[model samples]
Target chain A: MKRFWCLFFMIWPVLALYVCWIAPSMGWWFPFTGPTGMKAASPLGERIDDLFYMILYITTATFVGTQIALGYVLFKGAAATDEGNTEKAWYSHGSHNLEVIWTIVPACVLLFIALYQMDVWAQYRVKDSFPSETKQGAIAEVTARQFEWRIRYPGLGPDGKPLPLMPEPQPTDLYTVNDLHAVVGKAVMIILETQDVQHSFFLPELRVKQDAVPGLDIPVWFKASKSGDYTLLCAELCGWGHYKMKARMVAETEDKYLEFLQNLTKSQNYDGVPETPAEGAPVASAAE
Target chain B: MRSKLVALVLCSGMLFVCGCGRTEPQFSYREGLSPRVQEYVRTTVDEKFGTPHKIRVWDKLPIQAHTALATVGEGSKDNSLVVDISGASRPIEPGTEVVWVGGTIMPRGSAPVTVEAFTKDKNLLSLVAAPPAAPKAGDKIVIGPGQTLTHGRLLYAEHCQHCHGVAGDGQGPTAPYLNVRPRDYRKGLFKFTSTKEGMKAHRSDLARVIEDGIPGTYMPSFKLLKPEESHAIIEYVLFLAMRGESEFQMNNLLASDYSDASVANRIKDGETQEKVIEEFVTRVKEGEIDEEVNQRNEKMIADWVSAQAEDAVIVPKEKRNASDEESIKRGRELYLSGNLNCVACHGESGLGDGVQTYSVTKNTDTGKDNVEPGLYDTWGNKLKPRNLRLGMYRGGRRPIDIYARIEAGIKGTPMPAFGAKLTEQQKWDIVNYVLELPHELRTPGTGVAPASPATKPAPVATTAH
Candidate 1:
């Protein structure tokens, strides 16, 4: 019965360790691998990931050390309780030195983590710390409503380059829903606002999140390291249809992005007229 | 101890096995008709379009593509049916039920008869019971619940039924809380459509709404759905809308004479109760009500089909006028001009708080004055004129979109069409001015023109911070 208790106590730690060891390979680790494993998609995201790993290592070491000490003590105590043994079991109220060491150690570790993550935190939240390119202007305005993301981009100018996005919607502004496009490898910013309740803009791949408080214009920025489609989701429970707020961010090359804006302008101004009328044909007759 | 462990393991194993199999939730048709409909009207509609479990799709309706349609071939006999299975989207085997959907020969909408035996080689079917009348050549038949509609029903249940209601009545569980109510498709009136006035919305218009969603409203985009999946859902929505419309027309047919209020009025006017009852029975017996209903149903089907035609769409005769200072100036004049009288509803400053909203108006239903002064749509829901300064256009924000709204007017609303009164150029001018309403700075209270950049007026309520 004593052996059974000792083995039962020891089995839990072994199972926990085994599960942790296989978690990454099973695509169950943090950073939400998505299709790619444990790799952040942005430069700042990489730094954030590094900080996450640092804390994870510290916690893992603490967990294993405590579990091993528990198992060893359990086994030793079980052996001492054998029927043939007559040794006196030593018991103490507490160890002052052990308590002092544990308290100071965790306090120092918490202090270190706080100090280490300050730079990333400032870069993410502090407006002055944003990249110089993003400081110029926001690329688009994202308005989160009941259950959708409405994106508005600046219309292209005569030079075929995008005009500066105005704080107010311009007549030339182009609109799209649930689709946010940005140029890859460049830090771009978006002005986030909510028409109704509170919503959180979460980009899991880029490790970026910001709360879109009503009556406030929040700025959120990220640079995609590689060009691809990533998810944009609302992490906050805004309403009954909160789960329906799913959008995608498409990061592409500069030329492709410009072409997209040009196409949007053309479509937004569509006058029910065909693009090119048949040769020597009347344009008005084509609609029928 | 070993026996206890074995028992524990066996019990857990049974639990795991039980959890393995999952049953797909079945969707059902809406059960009862609206309370406004008479009892006889409900019975007639139900007989023509079966119950929840056994839905009968009328062949003449535009919803035929959603069902598995088969044609009665030349070799069909009194006892056996020879069908062309080309329209059958899903597999059909013995014991499957088939419904005869076409032709006027079979009365009271034929019931679904099961196939006892079938031979694939000869495309022959032997029914367990004979149909009321032999299905002649070119008659339409449906085998089982149509696969497309089945797929559509499942998707609609998951994505749309929460707010659209199972009957597409706009009274879903989450509807009451919304300020701008979800559309009641029973009237077949969509506010934002590319088609001309008095026409049903084109399939593309509805698709765009699903893909882009309506801004300033609770309807969100479901752009992630595959094209085919979206199409199937649209078909299902159309089915519900058409079914609701059919019931609504039938209720109207009897409501004028046989309604509770109408019958009471007749009794007050010195007619015996027995006389009114006798009149209704005679009408039903002579099939006069049925003929009227059939005529209305045929008209509804024709209108829906005609809306799909190319000419039904409103096409601009000329390209849009350039949005310049001169065009904006001309548009502002037209806005305040008595000819357009846009200021009656849309305030002089375009705040949507015009005098019309505060004045008492006649109720169209009872021909009496309304207690509260407000604008009400055909659906009996109170609506406010759009605040143009907010820069939120529900139908759409495109220049051509505004043009269409001006030309055709918003269907099922107080907004009247100016297409006949105004020329194409004049309409374009208003489009330009309305588009610029958000950006144009105006003096508050005075309703004056754009204030000079030097003189600062009271702050306007801008959408932006």
Candidate 2:
């Protein structure tokens, strides 16, 4: 009975590992967000995904090893307990060698990983370290307010003003609410701000999330390889109306991007004379 | 003994495996909430549409466990019989039996009994063979204070609950933050319904709102959602609207019937007043007075249900008046005219800051009005009349959309229908005036004179206004 009990206990650690890690990896249900996270949409996202898998592999191995060791300890101790040999180890001396080996091994492995990940981290976070090919001046400034995103683009004549509806944006600044338009294959930059509280400008597929803190102007950039309409969700719990704080990111060919801006401009200004700009749209900056 | 122990271990091991093998039971529409809500199970007097209802739970609670039981009365839109947890908090799994105040649940076709749970508790719940014929004011109406969590409720809680209140009152957690508040369905009214007349916001109208959201508001188009899922949401929204309407009616009826003045009128003097008051109270409790209330309720429910009748709309008799400057000039003259009264609600500058600024008055029944109103809509919340200076239209900004808004007044709001009062040309004139209000207001100095044909700027196709 004792042997059986010990054996059952021995397998529990293994069972847990199998259920939490192995089963999920085998498609039983890991990636609890559903299936696999949609394939990353940008080069930066792909790099992030690669880094994620590398850490996952190392951690998974360590987890399986630890659980197996736990099972082995229980399995070997079963015989002595069953035979009524319940004796305590009196020797207080710890195995310094074993401790050193375990500690040093993990430290070395982690050090190597940290050193290897620096480049990817810098490429993503450090503006100065960004690829020269993707560099572009601020395309638009997005302001986050209660339950909506107010986006402003540079308009013609150095002043953000409406141009006639045409296939081409008259190099004039434009503005829109709850929608962002950008040309695909070209790196785009946006200056983000928050009118009221904390908001995370999150693009899940692009693997981009930036906090828009009140009293701060944070710049974020991304390039879309594919042209399509994607979602911009407020990842932060800004307020009760956060769920409705959804915006559409329309990434397409240059022509389509211009077309979208033209239509929005018409809607924003309507008449040649300026009326109240699209609700939350900001007044054009003179310097820009 | 060893063999016995092995057998016991084996038996337990097998039992454990068997327990792990069975998955949570899948619910068929018959066995669960989705199909039940999809069908006309609980309906208003019209029976053409089902009564609206939804489950209420705190956002923190896991949506799966809670369920609701509604005591659906035949032919009457009774949204009473609310079921909720009493105590012992824990995550409930499938098939948990909930006992109600009116009696333990009985299977379909079981004979109805006068259970103490029903008569004793004001909930007045009866699942089988309809309910007791008469319901008095004293009878507790329980239109789902709680329900067995249904699939529809789950969907609504996830998608719509944050903005639309748990009961569809449009007072959700985020409702306060929005400049333009969402529609409160308690009045069972929607602003832009599909048809007008018999059924308010017909089935298609609800579907349209759900699919293509209202413009210039926080509402978004949910066209990406699957057909079945959107329909489920539609049904759930209706459930909430109907439930809210039922509660609204009940409150109104009780307040009027049991007012202090009415009670005083019942007893003219102290002498013989005790006996007379007792009789009056008895009359109220005996369901005698309910007959009249119920008749009124019938008309109210029918009016709500028939809001979608085809004839309930206003259409232009002739083609839209040309949007030329001359036409715009004609439109502007009528806009500032005293008869139209556009300047009263919409100010001189058309900034929506007119004479009705923050009109505060006491609610007669409650004698307390916390709400300060620029203008109160059907939901009793402050509504900002659209700033005509900004050509942002809530219903839509299209020519016909704007025209229709003028011809027929926006339902359940301060906007009145001009179709009856004004001719088509007159209504068209109003639409043109509204559309051009922003332009005229923007260039204040460039008014009336710009009406000359030769002096007028050429039409710009890009000019959305």
| Top candidate when judged by lDDT against the true structure | 1
Model 2 residue A32 distance off true place after TM-score fit, in angstroms: 9.6
- Cα lDDT of model 1 by residue, B1-465, tens digit: 999999999999999999999663222233343233355665676666543345566767776444356788898887588887765434465667777767526767567677777777888877888888877988887776555667777888889888887777888889998888988888777888888988888877888889888888899998877776778787777777777778777766677776677777888999877888787778878998889998988888888888889998888887777766677778889998999888888888898877778888666666677778987677777888889988888888777788889888888887878888888888888987888787666666533243122122112122333
Which candidate should be chosen as best, given DockQ against the real structure? 1
Reference-based lDDT, each prediction: 0.78, 0.58
Weakest lDDT window of 10 consecutive positions for candidate 1 chain B: B453-462
A202-237 per-residue lDDT for model 2 (tens digits)? 877677888888876666778766777677879899
- Per-candidate TM-scores read 0.79, 0.56
Global CA lDDT computed for model 2: 0.58
- List clashing residue pairs in candidate 1: none
User: Which residues of candidate 1, in runs, are more than 4 Å off?
Assistant: A1-38, A72-89, A277-288, B1-55, B64-145, B257-286, B364-366, B444-465
For model 1, the docking class works out as acceptable
